[model samples]
Target: MAKTFKYIILGGGVSAGYAAREFAKQGVKPGELAIISKEAVAPYERPALSKAYLFPECKFVMLLCLLSILGFFISVEFSIKIKISACLARLLNIFTLMSQLDFAAPARLPGFHVCVGSGGERLLPEWYTEKGIELILSTEIVKVDLAAKSLISAGGETFSYQILIVATGSTVIRLTDFGVEGADAKNIFYLREVDDADKLYEAIKAKKNGKAVVVGGGYIGLELSAVLKLNNIDVTMVYPEPWCMPRLFTAGIAEFYEEYYKNKGVNIIKGTVAVGFTSNSDGEVKEVKLKDGRVLEADIVVVGVGGRPQTALVKGQVEEEKGGIKTDAFFKTNLSDVYAVGDVATFPLKLYGELRRVEHVDHSRKSAEQAVKAIKAAEEGRTVEEYDYLPYFYSRSFDLSWQFYGDNVGDTVLFGDNNPASSKPKFGTYWIKDGKVVGVFLEGGTPEENQAIAKVAKVQPPVADVDQLAKEGLSFASKI
Candidate 1:
């Protein structure tokens, strides 16, 4: 018999969707693929959820106050309590709060079907179905019998495959792991899935006139703090690091955001650790206890410590390194005919010359596309070409949208307008290493500069005469 060409994809996130798309692009049809997901909804973008979802729903009190002020002409003493019975009610509340704010609210995003868990972004993996990929939703894979080339699902279904791709994304590390009692309660949540966002939304809705405390100062924590602050919730962000967003930004850059957040009424508590959560007699979280023996009074506590790979089903089938599945440059796992991508897969990066796990959505997309090529090459009896793409990630905070291209490994030439001015446009710095452009960091620079820097990062040009270039008052390329 001819080869069946069966390909089974585990986890219905962006990685799986992209992989499916790549496969379909290469003439792989419907019956040839299968996607298994625990979520009822498809994978969607998540970075904006913390800022967008929590904004209006969490700011019910502020909306009420504004409506009360505006309604002085309509009604003197009418009850105006904002509730979240549906998506529209929540959106109105968000709009109401934004009216009083200086920043415009992000556009409402459509939710997807595979995102069943709380705080799940439900828009990403919709393409899987649109592109004719099969999906098994609301199901979990129990274990993989690699020797038998079959896998058992939670529902006792066994699936045999010629090729299996694990795109299992990471799950947020729990605060309870750090010894917080009752941390498993519905109220205490780490923002990952849409359900988590909904839980936080409902909690903030109930305490419409109360405060929120966010644990951690990383991207998720900072973003959640911004969203809560935007909705007029009194927010205090606690981070163990000296400055927020330590992983992505320099201390000075993080301090800039800290000041900006503080100006927006978001209190940032640096050099602090969250020891545990304090629940009231009603069993609802009332306060967050810090390691400094100080109780931060809060109505809701948001844990944003970060995420670890959600790899349990194919545990023994694949070799793992530091909690991530190990993979070659071509995205192949330890097991023959098996592949992995997204947050769970740690593959070699020939570009940066290191073996690291990338958790960004862009990486997932690129890696998935690359994984397809590897599979196709393997099928054709040709060795797959090594995949080497530089890592890139970007985030928007308040008015600043910063993009970081390439990893900074102590080889960068800092440039651009580093002034903390709201009036002028921000610029960025370029990272040149060994005569090749390696990284770029932007502040409030022009789009042209940003694009030029990215292009230069890919191919670094020799530095020209500075004195003559400076006389023209031109772009960074001219000055350098």
Candidate 2:
């Protein structure tokens, strides 16, 4: 029999998680909503895979705690001793605080996944059952019949829905996609999901004190480089761009990071890319050949070139634009009862008066919530306001972090002290378009300061003097 749902969410990710919460808040009846995911586990904060999840000491502690709880039937005294040991290790800075524990064993159904980094309650499997929401995990939807308002799974099961929300997220682009030689060599990895993270983590552990070649200078590359370096792995980063994160980072901003990475014993190889890879007898990557005629020995290679939207499943079935599914301010597609959100949806950016596809986590959460709210309102014969989203992107590497708001178009004015050796080093960039500050980037900003920059980007106050704006820096955003 074909199961039916009042609302069906495709792709279990941050967007899907937030959408489920919104639907419940809107009084979705039990059994009316369901989430179909290809992953075996429920949605989690994906960003953690790159940040906290890669910490060796943290992973070790988690494994130990899980084994103790699941097997051996440890006594209460032993449990207390374990707790005290964890507390002492933390106090002595032995390992990253086990504060954000996820997926501890014995009771593995729900574990430490949810409200990542926010100290929020973990949403375990019981949470879904208690809410009467069907979690169709480990299922791939092979076909979608928009006219029939139904989708067929790979397992030959049919799912009918009154409304469908597409949130298929994205897939990591691999070197094989680019026809790089020996791309399938072992120890060559990419990080996009939990399994990917686990593979990379295990490789890092196996190749301790090894030489790592990181391809691409984007967030993943930068972050993984730092992670590898912290684990005492010698890292060399290769990218085709003149600087890192060219999409959002100006040369001035890149200068600081390049210097910082260099200080951390990382080799920055810019203006080139890995053309091929050579492997050992065991079919493991041993060397990386660069386009500029350089060969470097490597124990492991991590590639983070980029990713494309997972829109192929519905590409021709829906209106497409800007390399993603096209939607309006409210995330409504051209087809009725069909909506798209997150990285898959290139919706109108009212703030910029243009269409954009944001792949950041904040947008994923907000867009999903907006879509659900709009759907709920329409169901009640009411209408909701259009989604007005300001562009926001952020990243963390080592002890440094940054946040950017608005478009990175037009001329950029760099300011603040960006010297790598300076104490209390803080800096920012302003994207000026037509004598107005349209974008803001700040590193090491306090919560209040970040909000101030966001407001400046939203209002886009005029700046008559570029040099003055640079000189004033964060103060200019504060005044605005």
Candidate 3:
């Protein structure tokens, strides 16, 4: 009998979509594939959310068109949007880049079977329809019956498969767990999703010049705070950490951004934590009560504390640590006939000598490709290649475009151009680890120097030999 190799990959994000593509490229027939998502639209890149580049309407339209252009394989539903002008401009830029990169259209012929989760209403569903991918909108997976090799959805639909891959990404963890209440209140919110962004826009417009409180100091918090400030909303960011972006940047880099935000009229309170809310008789959030016994008045509160992997659907089949799925070098889960990738999966990286899970777009894309290769190799009874791509992510804060390369570890060396009067300023820092290059973080640097520093972070060569890196220990860049 011929081998019945059916694959049921869960989730319809970038990693899941990439896995489907790679599987097809490895000769897996369309009849042998099925992708189930909690969303209704097909998967697309998501890193442009905070870059002031993606607009809501334009993103929806372009993403629909692109799905039609790409080969039909899977469907996704990601309904999120930014309502502010600055965020709108960012979305517009994102739409432009989508067109420029030809990322909207697929380069292959579609002759495969794919399905999406139900929640993908309207144009979001149109993306899958345009590509002829199967989609079940307004539905969700309830449980994975691994013994039966099937999954049951909330709508009582059951799907069975020969192979299973879980690609559900991370979700924003609310502050309610820590007793920061009133998030469910009408004006208080979390802007991690497009719906949240829309609600924020509507709330801001409804309040008619209301003051806002942003709780948290991470990426989402900082970006949202900046947007609120640009719109003239009296915004304040409260964090337990002494500096902003502590996880992504060192103290020196974060200090620069902290002042930059404050100078832009944002009230940033560091080394403090939000414990709960103070609501008025109306049951709406009126003030944020901090652990230090201080209270800040505000009309609205946005909780952007951070997020954790969304792995509830495959909890038992996948081994987890600290809410993240643990995987081997091949991105394989503990269960047989199953694999995991993306934000939900953590694997070892030979490049950095650390077992970590990356939440960046590049990591997801590369890991998906790696997982596909491993699947193909396994099919042929060969040893799987390790998923070992280095993680790199960047962000834009006001006028600064910060780029991080490689796994950030070990000590840092700051550098800059000495010409104080130079119109074009340049600066950057290299991450050195164990006498080797492990990462590089650059901002306001010459394009040539940025490229060299990026390379050095990747390979960790001796800076003493390079003239470009002569100013290795410059103290700092202009504070944020």
Candidate 4:
């Protein structure tokens, strides 16, 4: 059967969820919009996968909260509340408050749904139902016939749309791709989706306190290393880069983190790559062999090498640039009634005056929203403003949190107290390009200070003296 919608989102990911929300805001009628997702659940805050999803403690705590809530309701039904002493009453009140707080912490399905990642209201499955939006879960689109404006699902279902959104996002690159020996062995994992996080959780339990080798120096590796250490698993991280997050972090910024990780008992091996792995009789990863002729014992191995854009479905049919689908400022592709957004869309970065693709959650959201707005505006024979995205990226691990804004190019200046051993450490960096501050990175900054840096990045205040600018540090941003 060929089901049809006015608009069909090809992939139900973070971008898909945000796009759906924007469509609703612009007034979507029932049967007008459909989202096809391979995932069993609605779109969720994906960053949680590397952060809280791997930790099973959240699920455990939620169970306790549910039990407490159920008991409270049962007691109320039995009229037991009236007979409680003042001290017992106080205890019950405290329990209620704690349960409420615990209920909010679990990064489970409904708790970390769309819009919640940006601090908006959590859009539950029922929210989609109430909005009259069709959410086709667990249905992967296997074939895309853009010429016919139709898509074929793995289950042989046909979905036709008047307008199509190509938002398949990216697929994780596994070590197996490079023919790394024993990469397919059991207990070797990659964290991308919710299921991957669940598998990691199971491995963490099965190999409690066992050794884990994290391959990759990206955010995923950093986050996994921290969480695995918290679970008492001996973690060793191996990467080819001299510093962690080389794509974004300067040497000084990376130094602070590398030292902090070492302080937290994490063994970091740099300038080396995993050559192969050795598995036990049970086909589980037993050790990791590095290019340096070093062998490290491992019960669980997480590979976060990188990912490739999920653009195969529309390959050769759309314009391509910078390894992603080419799109304009409003995320519109060359084809009529078709648009691309999220990590797959390499749109013009207005702030930089260049074409670039960003694989961050913040851009994913803004791009999705901008595409929807442009679509709606086009229908009304009107036009919308171009997307002027201010690059924003942030990461959280242990007691550390950092935010980066603007471009990370040109001469870099590291400032502030970046001493990893300080009782209270706070630091920042500025990227000066053509004599102007093009980027700012701040760690452990107050909310106001973070906003100040953001403004500085946007305005790009000129800096003549690098040394004096470093001396001024965050104060320069605050004045801006």
Candidate 5:
């Protein structure tokens, strides 16, 4: 028997989660929409896996004994007993590090589900059930017939849809794709989903205090290395870039992070890459051979080179651009009732007047919502505004965090006190194009400061003096 849905989302990822929410908001009837995903669980906040999810789990309960007027409270930290006055005043000062074993626990399932990532409602499985959206988990769609408006699963099941959303997302690029020797050996990991995150977590436990070699200097590499180091494991990071995060980070910006990671005892071997791997009798990886003829011993290897958009399903059925399905501002493809959003959509970047495929969580959420809103508006013979996105990128490692907005083109002026060794390092960089501030990057920025930078990017006010802007640093952004 062939099942059918009025609206069918092809992938159950971050974009799919957001799209489902938008569909419900637009008054979708029960049993009218379905989300098909290979993951066993509902979509979650994927970024958490590399950061909070990999950190240690902390469990603690507190009974605050205080009055409303006194403004004093005591936590379960009574174990670190001291004078009443001292305990009350010195709490935050002494809270230093909380060892990840105390205080709040690490992120886990249900803690970081989708929608919450964008400060919206947490779309749990129950929420989907209430909305009557089918979560076809653990089912891989092996075949697609766009003209027939149908999808076939590996299990020999067929699903038909009137309006189709191709949100299959991106697949992790592994070393095996390049035919690196021993790439398929055990203990070599590439993370892109909840299952991959779980596998890496288990490896961290099984190889406690073991040596780990992180390949690639990108998001997953930097984050996974920090997680391993936090677990008291020895970490060595290898990348071919002149510095870490060469894609978006300036040399000066990369310098600060490289220094910070080194300060944390992370061995960074830049200008090199893993050429091959060697496994032991049990097929557990033991050593990673680099292109520079350097062989480093490693109990496990984590690769985070990059990802390729999964656009094969709609290969011959749609127009493509920038290696993704081509779409207009409304995320509509050449075919009617078919749309593409998230990492797989190469829609017009209205800000830049060009097509772009952003591979980040922020874009995924916004694009999905825009597509749904456009769909609903069309049904009512209304029109929605084109998606106007402000490029936003962020990452956290150890106690360091950074946020960047807008395009990274033109000349950049680095400013502020960027001393990585300082107790509180604050710094920013501005991209000047045609005497205008087109982009901004800030580390250790507060909420107000981050919003200021985002505004600066969006507005792109003119700058008369590059020197003055550098000297003013974040203040320039605030003024704009």
Candidate 6:
């Protein structure tokens, strides 16, 4: 017999959690919605994996207690006092509480995850049960019939739905995908899910004081470099780009991080990539061969090249653009009663006037909420406005963090103190298009300052004097 649902969310992730919450708010009755996920647990906030989850001191109870106190203070004093929002305030509180308790210890299965970084309470397995929201965990859907509005599981179970939300998210890109020989050698890792993080953490412990080669210059590469280094491993980073984070950082900004990493005892090998791997008799990676014909010994290799959308299930069944499932402002696909969100959805950027696929956590949460609101409104014979999103991306490593908003197109103006040796160490960049500030990036931004930059990017006010704008720097954003 085929089970049926009025609503079905196809992935367990940040988007799925938010969608579930929105559905509940919209009065989804018992048995009306089901969330099918391959993960053993419900959705959780994924960003913590690369950040606080890898901290070495996270294992100490005293340190965790201190972190909890600190997190609580910050959540109540800063987050709540700023009137951020009830949801954001709760998220901040939970983040701090969990960081001290859950993340302070080595992440245990089903124990350390935080659900919905913002908004409501963490959705535990019991929460789903109490809400009567079916959670089909650890189940893989083998096939989908879009026209028939049904999906088939690997175990021969059939599920039908009146509406489908494709929140499949993304899959990590493996080195083997690029034809790197011996890429599957043991101790070579890629981080995406909880399992991957656990494996990497275990490998680091097993191979302490060993050599590590991180292949990639993006967020994953940079973050893992710090993580491995913190684990007392000798770290070397390799990337084809001349500078790290080339997609976002200008050469000037890259110079600061490059120097900072070098100061932290990290060997940066830019303008090259790993082409092959040498393994021992145990099928364990021992060395990495570079494109320049150089071999470097490696006890472990971590690749963070990037990820591709997990859209293989619907690639041909639905229209795709920009390497993802295509959607409109409401996150609706061309097919009726079908939609997409999170990393898999390439929707129109109403703010930028083009279609874009954002892979950040913020967009994942916002898009899912938007889609649910639109769906519920339609069901109630009402209409919701189209999504108007301002692009945002952020990353954190070591003692530094940054945030970016809006499109990174057109000319750029670097400003503020970029010197890695500076005491305060605040810097920013502005992307100008047609004499207007279209993008903003800031390192070491306070809450108010980050908001200012976001506002500047959103309004895209004119910048008549590029030189003056650079001179004003953070002041320009403040004044605006």
Per-candidate TM-scores read 0.80, 0.89, 0.76, 0.91, 0.92, 0.89
| Tens digit per residue, CA lDDT, model 5, 180-212 | 999999989999987888888889989888999
Ranking by lDDT: 4, 5, 6, 2, 1, 3
Q: Over the stretch 73-140, how does candidate 6's per-residue lDDT look in tens digits? A: 67667663455576477566756766555344444545434453665577787878888899999999
Off by over 4 Å in 2: 58-112, 117-121
lDDT of 3 at 414: 58
Task: Write the residue-wise lDDT of candidate 3 on 1-480 in tens digits.
Answer: 222337777887667666766765677754576668776545644443443322212355566756653422221122234345645565566567666642322111121112121122222434444444454444578888777788888877788777777887888777766655665566788754444555776666666567888888988788778766655678889988978888877876776677667767889888888877778787878988888999899888888888888888777765887467888888887876887888888787787676777787677767777877887898899886566575677766555566777766677665664232344435556666666556777767555655665565556564433334434442211110
Off by over 4 Å in 1: 1-5, 57-132, 380-385, 411-421, 430-437, 445-447, 460-474, 477-480
The lowest-lDDT stretch of 10 consecutive residues in candidate 6 is 107-116
lDDT score at residue 95, model 3, on the 0-100 scale: 61
Task: Compose the digit string of candidate 1's lDDT tens values, residues 123-228.
Answer: 3445566656667778788887767777777888778888888888988888777667656544676887777777777777687668888889987887778777
**Model 6 residue 318 lDDT?**
91
Q: Which candidate's lDDT is highest?
A: 4
lDDT of 2 by residue, 4-101 (tens): 99999999988888888788778888999999998888888888777766765546667775564544344433565556655455444423334555
Candidate 6 local lDDT, residue 269? 96
Q: How do all the candidates rank in terms of TM-score, highest first?
A: 5, 4, 6, 2, 1, 3
State in Å the error of residue 442, model 2: 0.6
Cα lDDT of model 4 by residue, 144-233, tens digit:
988898999888999999998888888999888889999999999998788888888888988887999999999899999998997789
lDDT for 424 (candidate 6): 62
lDDT of each: 0.71, 0.86, 0.66, 0.90, 0.89, 0.88
